[model samples]
Structure formats: structure tokens, C-alpha cells
Target: MTEHAATGPVTRSMAVPLGAFAAGAVVAVLLGVFGRVHDPTLSGTTDLGFRTVIEMKVVVSTVIGVLVVLQLVGGLWLYGVLGRRVPSWLGTAHRISGAVALLLTVFVGYSCLWALGLEVGTLHNGEKVPVRAVVHGVLGCAVFGAVVVKLVAVRSRRAPGWFLPVAGGMLFTLLMVVVLTSAAWYVATDGWPSRAGY
Candidate 1:
């Protein structure tokens, strides 16, 4: 029984969640790049517009990169630790990684809201920027909300370990939505640079 448990169902059961995490990470990286499409080019040009805009872009990119790396490390560690059974050290690393990832995500969401140009006051083309900005903002907030729920569950010793994974999945979906909708918006407007105010 011990050998079977070690080699069979235990190992196989871990695969599903691990695969989900891998897929989510891939989606996050791709979507993160799209989220920062308007950011300064690699050379870091800042003279073309308000400093706030460029600063916000840099903040968003930095936060996204940090969160992405944290997530990848956490996901990989989680798969290994959960699969082989948690060790003392990896468990601590997992907790630390999770906390850092959540913190970065919260900031990333703030940056994302502005990056989408949906801040409290902003006029774009005589009308507020597209509602898609709101959608992206709300979704980003939801991801942060999920992390809060998961943290509460952890401290309280909750039964199900569903909140974190659910949060991850929601974040992934939101990223995709933001990417596609923003692309569509850009296309419809004939590009931001070509507009009169731009």
C-alpha cells in the first residue's frame, strides 16, 4: 500500500493542478506583455508625453514582471512539494512566495487600472475611454480580492484549498479579456498616436 501510494494515485493526482498552473503562467506572461503595449519602448523614451504616463507604464511592467517570476517559482515549488509531499523548507518557501506574489499583484492591479487609462478622471476623444477599461480594472481587482480570500482561508484553517487556484484562474481569464478587448479598441480607433490629441 505504501509503495502504491507513493508511485500511483498520489503522483497522478498532482499532475492536474500542476498542468493548470503551467497553463495559467503561460497565459499570464503573454497577457502581461499585451497589458503594457503602450509602455515606453525598450530604450525607455519618456519625452513624448506626460511623465506620469511613462512612470505608470514602468510601474506596471515592473510589477507584472515581479509577479510573474514569483508565480512561476511558487507554482513549480508547489507542484514538487505537493507531489512528493511537503518538506519543511519548501513549505516555508511556498508561503513566502505566495505572500510576495499577492503583494505584487495588488500593486500590479493598481498599475493596470491606470495603464488601461481608466483612472478616476481622464478624457479620451471627448468621451471617457472605452468601457473595456472598466472591465479590465474590475477583473484586476477581482484577482486581488481572490488573494485576500485565500489568505483568510489559510489563517483560519479552512477546509477546501480552492481559493488560491480559483483566483489564479480568474486572473488568467481577466488578462485574456484585457488583451483581446484592448486590441479591438486600438483597431477601432485607428491607433492612439494617429488621433488628434495624441
Candidate 2:
């Protein structure tokens, strides 16, 4: 009689997650360190007014946040995590959404890092910085890092079956954190573009 062999060691299964986590952490640390060293003034100028660019970023981020949600839903559907049969076309939709999301993220990240640097708070002659701003910057870096991890997990042939789902979840959560701290905060404080006080 023939017997079936079990899967390999638990450590082998964990390799992808551990590697992705390490890579993401490295990316976050690098971005934070870069922001600390770089001067905001040295950033590239946009043809649009400063406030206009900021407002544009907010809009883009909101749209990206929506896309992230859709991506998450698509992922869930594809994995049968919702206990529903995934349509064949759903895979294509998910890929398209993921591509668009990544593109949007790249644009926003460039604009943020180039135009604003890591703006924690306004430094007075003697005053305490706002904790929110600091948290926002940290989360922004983490968003990028999570994206990197997701991309790596998706493309890696050796990655475990669970890697993509976990990476996608992390990416979605980080994106939401970034949106809440930056775009949502902006909308709350400034309202929409036309009515924004700048």
C-alpha cells in the first residue's frame, strides 16, 4: 500500500512570512531615516499651488483607499474565504485593481515625500510637537513597507499559500491607517477643495 507524506517542517512554511516581515520592517525604517535627513525645501516643485497639490493628494488618497477595500474584497472572494464560488473574471478584476492601487500609491508616496517630507509638526521657538503628526509619518512609511511586502509575496514562487493573503491584509490595514491619519484628517480640518482654508 502507498502512503501519503505530510507537508514539510513548520519553519519552511513560515519562511515567506518571516522574510516578508523583515523586508517590510527594513523599508519602514529606511523611509523614516530618510525623512529625518532630507530637507523639505529640497523637494521638487509642482506646477500646481502647494495647497492645490495637497488637496489633490487627499483626493487621490481617498480614491486609493476605496480601491484598497475593493482589492480586499476581491482577495477574499478569490480565496473562497467568504465561502462563495469566485467567478473566473474576478481574478482579472483583482489584478487590475491591485495594479491601479500600486500605481496610485506610487504617485501619492512620491508627492508626499518630495513635497512635504515627514511633517511631524510646526516647530515653535519652544513648543511641543503634535503626536498625531508623528504617528501619521510613521504610518505613511509603514504603508509603503506593507506594499513592498505584498508585492514580494505575490511574485515569489516559493512563498507559502498563506503568504499572499496575509500580505494583502497587512497592506490594506496600513493603507487605511495612512488614509485616516492624513487624508481623513485633512478633510476634517479643511473640508473639500473649494471651501478649504489651506
Candidate 3:
């Protein structure tokens, strides 16, 4: 009975986000596999340049980009000021939400590395170079570390109060910094000024 009670809420809380994420994963896999079989490499550069590739990159990037922004910003606010005072359910939700965000953060980092050659030693000369890859990489690492720290805090209930909150703030700052830098890099390299060959 006690075991059932404990497991029940955990399952309930995780259901919605886990379900949506799973469905999205299935769709992405289907598209990637089916789309690649016919096209092999999808779109690449042309004399007209990489309009399709760039647009596809931006659409997915922008969606996950906004989500990362929201999680970092909102997570910080929740953990820093209100964490001490919030009811237990809210705190549990905060941790659950953060776990999901960390998963997204890792996925985005790896996807960018594959899709845009953002990882070190991955870029071919002609690929679009993200000016902020190093910064984003560092933040991605930090996000991973913070997730560990958060988990430790949850497990060790006597963990220092400051550990979790500081981690939250760090995540918030790192994400925003990466997003702004990436945006700047995109504009600088791909904007009309460069496109016009000026």
C-alpha cells in the first residue's frame, strides 16, 4: 500500500510530458528515416544557396530555443525566491519540470552537433559556422552538471539549500547567454548584408 501510494503520484506527474515527448520522438524518427531513404542527405548547398536547410534548422531551433529560454528563466525564478516557501507539490513539480528541461537541453546540444556540425572537429568548411558553439557547448555541459547536482540534492534531503538554488541561477544565465550569442551568430553570417555579397 505504501509503495503503491509513492509510485502512483510519480507516474501521474510524469505521464503528460513523457507521453508528448515520446510521440514527438516517434514522429522525428519516422521523418528522419523515411525522408533520408529517398533523399539520402536531404538538402545541401546549391547555387541558390541553402534555403531549405537553413529554414529547417531555424524552425526546429527556434521552437527548442524558446523552450530552453523559458525553462531557464522560469526555473531560476521558481528555485531562487519561491523555492523555500512553495508547498511540497510545487517543489516536486519544479524538480520534475527541471528534469524534463535537462533532457531537452542535452538533446538539443547533440542534435545541433549533428545537424549543424557545431561540435569540435565536426564542421566542414562550407557549413554554417555558429559563432557561439563554444559558449553553447559550455552551457550544455553546465546543464548536465546542474542536473546531477539537483538529483543529489533530492536524494540527500540534508543537501545544502544553496546548492540547488545556485544551480538554477547558473542554468538560467547560461541558457540566455547561449541563445543570444547564437542568434547574433546567425544574423552575422546569414543576414542580407552577407547574402548580398557586401
Per-residue lDDT of candidate 1, residues 23-56 (tens digit): 5455444444454444423232232342444343
Off by over 4 Å in 2: 1-13, 42-51, 121-127, 195-198
Which candidate gets the maximum lDDT versus the true structure?
Answer: 2
lDDT of 2 by residue, 1-198 (tens): 323236443343567778888988999989887876777653464524445677878888888999999998898888788898889899999999889988988888877777667766565365655787788788888888898899888877677887888888888988888888778999899886542454
Predictions in order: lDDT = 0.48, 0.80, 0.49
lDDT (10s digit) by residue, model 3, range 1-198 = 797696664322333333433443454444334322333333333222334444433433455456666555455556564355545565566556556666655555444433443243334575753546655654544544444544544454344455445545555666556655554456566652222232
Candidate 2: which pairs clash?
Answer: none
Model 1 segments more than 4 A misplaced: 1-50, 57-62, 81-89, 108-125, 161-164, 171-198
TM agreement with the true structure for every prediction: 0.44, 0.82, 0.47
lDDT of prediction 1: 0.48
The TM-score-based order of candidates, best leading, equals 2, 3, 1
Find the 10 residues in a row with the least total lDDT in model 2.
Answer: 1-10
